[model samples]
Target: MSIPAFADISKSANDLLNKDFYHLSAGTIEVKSNTPNNVAFKVTGKSSHEKATSGAIEGKYADKSLGIKGRVYLLLPTCHPKKGVKLNLTFKQSAFHGRAFFDLLKGPTANVDAVIGHEGFLAGASAGYDVQKAAVTGYSAAVGYIAPQYSAAITATDNLSVFAASYHKVNSQVEAGAKATWNSKSGSAVGLEVASKYRLDPVSFAKAKINDRGVAAVSYNVLLRPGVTLGLGASFDTQKLEQATHKVGASFTFES
Candidate 1:
């Protein structure tokens, strides 16, 4: 990064002058004159923070999962008579496995949820559905809204909640639910999630207690005949939530 060629100074209540994070991106989108009906792909690469090497344990950085992320999105143009704009789908992916041994313990029992941010999450927990026989997992998904530079929301944009789901697999049985998102306020990112899950552990006993709301089970995983990585991060959220509540855990991608 170079010394900024430009600067925007702001005054605080104390009249003290403070400099904000340096300017990195120009907030603009370009549309070609050729194709108007379709949206195309776009990519941006920048350094967020820098550090060197090793292992996965907890959060994003502290455990050694620090590096730049390649971000992606879709672009669309306004038509001759059309009002407003259109956006193609977007997604975020990471290179390591994430872990959370502690239960969200308590929160909405429903199986699906969403939050406004760069990553949408999915999750499910079961106390002891079945040991050596049952496997359970939670699931969630979210799309980061108002990219930081283009939209002021990066600093304070309620990320639009997109979609969510949760599921479990045991023996030969799979139980899952689907969810949708909605936000009444245009400039803000708020959404509702809905879903349900049913489980049967016997590999032959594909049945749920019918009376159970949210499920919990004992889960343990090991991957490296190879490597390890760990990163830790936390944030203070200022979201206006719907009376329907949710739990915030980690985003996950896995392998044997």
Candidate 2:
């Protein structure tokens, strides 16, 4: 097993609680296509009841060790066509991976990250430098161990003010994970979240998660066809169930 990047140290647990849940107030649609020349294209459109509709177009090309990706956002109402472009370059090898990102819209910022793994152990760090301010804005470091069926990681982020630890375990049909974080600067309460995913069948799965903030969520995903997937999810405020503030969302994706 290969260790993930610093930002992805808790990816398994985070994905179970966040990805495909899509508990937005509106709808989202995504389309993807791949070409024989190793180029991939994707378009995503989202609708919001409180704001105008928005979309983005992304393209990527990759080979054995190098990859490049670009995306342009379509801001509604008044779109600045050129300012929304973002670019990313990535390189990967058996024991090392690196990435660079450029955001043309926000401070026209650039960030870089690198990770190295060997013998199931990993170490990585990331830094973001603000081009406008000409100073290092933020940085983080992480260390972890990955195995065939389980993984553990610890990280210090926010300029070392926040520390987090996570663990994930997987079996044939069940996946479970937990994460905890504490902020040294505030010396406040620790934040905790746990999630689980269960494979209902070969084509479908269910996920559920809860946090210390009295919030809970559940989601179900099913493959309707060979290249089509559907996801439905809902979230609730356990402490204020009578407030009628719960949310439900659905998402559809197609790939070819």
What residue runs in model 2 are displaced by over 4 Å at the alpha carbon? 49-52, 65-78, 84-91, 102-110, 130-134
lDDT of 2 by residue, 1-256 (tens): 5546567766765676567666664678899999997778888888764555877777776674543444444434454455455778777788987889888778889889998999988899999988988999899888888888988888899987899998999999999999999999988899999889999999999988889999998888999999999988888999999997788878899999
* TM-scores of the models, in the order given: 0.15, 0.85
> Top model by lDDT, which number?
2
Instruction: Give me the displacement of residue 181 in model 2, in angstroms.
Output: 1.8
What digit string (tens of lDDT, one per residue) describes model 1 on residues 39-115?
22322222222322222222111122543323233223223542333221222234112222222322212222212
lDDT, candidates in the order shown? 0.22, 0.82
Which residues of candidate 1, in runs, are more than 4 Å off? 1-99, 103-133, 149-256
Each model's backbone clash number: 30, 0
